[model samples]
Target chain A: MLLTALFVIVCVALGAGVGIYTSRDYTASNAVKPAVEGFLWPNPRIIQPFSVVDQHGNPFGLENLTGQWSFMFFGFTHCPDICPITLSLLSQVQKKLAEQDTADKVQIIFVSVDPKRDTPEQVADYVSYFSKNLIGLTGTEEQIAGLARQIGVVYIVNDETAPGDYSVDHSASVFLISPAGQWLGLFSAPHEVDDIINRFNTISEYIKKQE
Target chain B: MRYSSGFLFFILIAVQSVFAQNSIEITDVWINEAPPTVKILAGYFTINNHSDDPVDLVTAHSPSFQKIEFHLTETQDGVARMQKLETISIPAQSDFSFSPGEYHLMLFNPVKTTKAGEMISLQLTFSNGTNIDVEAEVKRSELPPHHHHH
Candidate 1:
């Protein structure tokens, strides 16, 4: 009986160790599904649902992204620092792409966390300063919040959470949604434009192979 | 040898004057560019006055534009406002600035777009009727607000 008990404890210990070793640094909130992998790379969080309006006041659903890979960031125009830097980084990517004469195969979308103040015109003006082709999206507070939830982008407004009274706290990752409207992958903060372009190219090749 | 010694003595005096002379140091400078460019950015680094007396910043001029003044931009309730301070005081043997949203060297009304890798010259006027010229490196868009900055 003593020997059997000792053996059971050993098995439990090994099982626990294995579980930890495999999923270290991973979050349960984003672990519901294994990210799809393609083009010699692993794609994270490959599919999510959302609905918002574009700068043109036109309805923009996830389905609208079906034909082109979209790069999405969550932020507002009033943001003084990080949002602009990230947007600037995207702008750099676009500039870099333009310099290479790469035909527009990608889309850059900005989703405002400060929906109350970032009117469609304001959002357009803010983003246009960085890149003319960029798209800004906003909607009712609840609508935007629900859509951000569907994906894993998190934004924390100041304690008040009231429009025009708080600052937004958001994730810094740049997400890549495939042409099929799938959440193909995400590039964590400290994004490099080259890496995004390389990954986009690699995924395009994979998608082509699949087709 | 006597002539060389005199020349060396003169050079030493010149060097001493240069070191003991009062100078203003500015760092982490930034400005906000919103509608009306009201919110300018200025941060990081302190001003050290080695002189024996206090120094006052009378005004600041940015060479990038015809108009560059000493102003503070504050954001409240989605509205950004600017305030012009009469003077910025830097006590002797002490430092000032290196603080956030306070005491900034604002640059605006650019004569033209400021490109990267170009040095910007800012003329700083002090209370002692002295003008110190300082230079700042041009950095790309500072991240939008929301992240912590000092």
Candidate 2:
């Protein structure tokens, strides 16, 4: 009787130990999923080919975004407040990346929704004020809309009281595109510099693991 | 006794001056300097109403810009839209701030390139029959400090 009781206690202890170890292993493997806020992982949407002109009047398509990570923002030069503020924050992000020697690995793109007013030359001049490394893209209304629709960006040109007087209401989120030209995700408006950098690093690491 | 009397007189004079001047106070006036090609700029400040009644800001004009208008930038569902406000009312004994991404003074067609550190003069008219002059400095936006979580 004494031998049987000792045997039963030993078996139960072994079973509990194995159960705890298996459960911990299960959770450890599941941690591979991207945990960053606002990150679209597992199934980032592949971008279709769409054409727009860059600041230098070069045709920019999905192929142009294939070489490096891209941070894209949609706004016009006429906007005095939010556009500049967002662009400045992006410039700071670019600067911080440069400090980490990862600047060349990433590219910043600004797309103008107000194509009627933001010509390629105008965009060229406007982007230069923010960062020399920044790429400004603008094109016809249809061209702009084609790309915007694919990325789920919405913009509206308010009725103008005069020829040169109006405002373009547009989505203020900053989009992150992978080097493979996939729409990874977006950082919502009122963005902070540290938050963006941290998320970018997280997403980048996750993408590396998948490869 | 003489020192106490003098202090009372000083208090009385201060009270008289407070009543003689406008009941509205302005501070922290500054403008966000934009690129040279950009036609419009944003100006920010804080308004304090010390009076017992609400005050309405009716008109604002600046010699440095061709036109000045009160505009509010409202963000809804990730879309940012700008609306013009004809008058901004400040309740009594409250503080109102005009900051980035919110209510601001839309300065259009600058008379000249306003550089950072330069002062722009503005005149504001209130519904309470008070006219106050303000000078706002042009400044570049600075990145906020990083927040660390323990």
Candidate 3:
């Protein structure tokens, strides 16, 4: 009877060791897996304190970006082709993430380059047409430029002889900001909903593992 | 079924030509509806030249809009910019598609608020003294309403 009991204890110990070893292997494999297809910086870029206003005329700055991951795109409301299209696609991304039950922690911010024309009320109306989850922001040229420069978003207002007959040439890239208010990476133009969601999930998992 | 549909499309084109005397025929006309706060919108369509000679589209007129311009959105070094074109030439038996993110008609200052699902009228004038009137739907940016490509 004692011999049988010893054999049973040995089997149990061996099984437990194997289980632990497999788990260690899994962790090591996951750590080496790539997060997403973004141009991830070697170090997270820190954002400075630049004041802007939200669609509701509330203060929005670097502090507001704390505690949540953000995807920000720089465009104006009057941009007929790219701005509305990008915002609409981001809305689809938000909806898909919500359906997957992962969008509660993510935010999409639309920062307008033409603060002279895009008032808070106008921005509010424009964003509400797409999705309530989107946050619209605009500010004075200097303040907006400060934030734009930090993220490498460029915009130049064209000169037109007729009033309201010009366009603003701006960067068409979507930037990813970490939950700790650091610029994480950037996704280039022609963003797809499925690709964005998968990349976001992968990045989130990777960030959690790193933490 | 495919042959029958193709025949029907040809018949439809014949009928359109009978009415408009087609020097330049436009199909798949659509306009991207602007947000409530925006005053500018863009129109997309395909222009087909049915004549034996080339045709130059000189101007676009829309009574519903204050001004119209032929604009193309081009990206250079990741910067999206708009370039206004003076005219677009359609060669004989050739087609030019004014699609989104490419060549489009920029309609500014809408006389009436244009929402999705509404139709607007546009008149296109050619350098050869030909004009074609077309009606297009204002579509949401996400949903491309029509994709009838040949």
Candidate 4:
């Protein structure tokens, strides 16, 4: 994965260099993926079909993110620490993008791995608590599993001997979808908000230039 | 008279066994590591099993909270993961400490009255149907909800 990630870095760097030359936007410097020493981007996985409803109580399919780069995350609203932290990191990515003043693009989506409990309203409340732009999604158990499987995320709910009294085991990686809604790549766990912001900033420019 | 010494030895063994069977001792208990508003907590302490057999801890009941379960906090790929444990194996004559970011007990949805420095009575049920009640002291620091694995 290290060599593959380095190759990705080279691709992103080359794209950034080209974008800088054409756009002449110095503020977009934030878009350049600043090399984070010791940080390795995990290989992107093929995403499976994910069925979920958006925060607005509307059914949102995977194709909904078409034409835009998305940072997709799987988590539950009830999660206290890690959930907030991940969302905050994604928000930082958005903030950095705005700081760079790059071409208008990017959306962050949060998919609720715990569906039976997280209603649309609950999703909205949870995401809104972090950032208004953050999208919280929920769906039935089967739909959620399909999406999780596609993203290489596995979440298991162990028995606590009672309903609603269980814990879920899930993958920790954040999914990154391309403008065409294809699962492009993913950001692994232990990611810092600034690191994500910087990397996405770099990727955003590449995405815009490809168009 | 010859039977008297044998009787004494058996009595001594019985007395020793009383303290040796599923003896659970607890110290340094607290719940304030994160915050009560967060609705989750991890309690830690040492349990020294003095019995001669394995004790399978299955269930935990608490009067201070709505529900209590055995849980473990593990960080996979730096993502904090929390899960409820179905059974914990406590070997005889050894100690098991339930601490943060490791083996722990998850106490959820405490009532408004439950506060720091309060005593929480949690009963641990074993596979053999023996149960030991432990009194834990809620710490000054709020108990964190999720394990922050790095």
Which regions of candidate 1 fall more than 4 Å away from where they truly are? Answer: A1-49, A98-104, A160-165, B1-24, B27-150
lDDT by residue (tens digit), candidate 4, A1-211: 9999999999999999999787776556544543543222333343444567888888887677777778888877655435555676677777677777666578888988889878888788768766788888887888888877776666766566465656555656777787666665667775666666766666655555545
Lowest summed-lDDT stretch of 10 residues in model 4 chain A? Answer: A37-46
lDDT of 3 at B86: 98
Score each candidate by Cα lDDT.
0.65, 0.89, 0.85, 0.68
Give Cα distance to truth, residue A78, candidate 2, Å.
Answer: 0.4
**Candidate 2: tens digits of C-alpha lDDT, residues B1-150:** 557988999999999667736579899899998888899999888898988889999999998999999999998999999999999999988988887788889999999988899999999899977889999999996442233410
Give me the TM-scores for chain A across all models, comma-separated: 0.72, 0.84, 0.86, 0.73
Write the number of the candidate with greater DockQ, choosing between 3 and 4. Answer: 3
Q: How much is the TM-score of the A chain of model 2?
A: 0.84
Each candidate's interface RMSD (Å, one decimal) is 8.4, 1.5, 1.8, 5.5
The candidate 3 chain B region of ten consecutive residues with least summed lDDT is: B141-150
lDDT of 1 by residue, A3-87 (tens): 9999999999999998887666353333343233322234445455567888888888877787887888887665554466678
Write model 2 residue lDDT over A4-88, tens digit each, in one string.
9999999999999999999989756756876887788777789999999999999999999997999999999999888988999
> DockQ for all models, in order?
0.11, 0.58, 0.48, 0.10
Error of 3 at B101 (Å): 1.7
* Global local distance difference test of model 1: 0.65
lDDT (Cα, tens digit) per residue for candidate 1, span B1-150: 657988999999998767655455555554433322213234223577877788887877775766554545443432233355678788887767633333344444466655545567777778877776766665556543333432
Looking at model 2, give its docking quality level.
medium
Pick by DockQ: 1 or 3, better one: 3
Model 3 in CAPRI terms: which quality?
A: acceptable
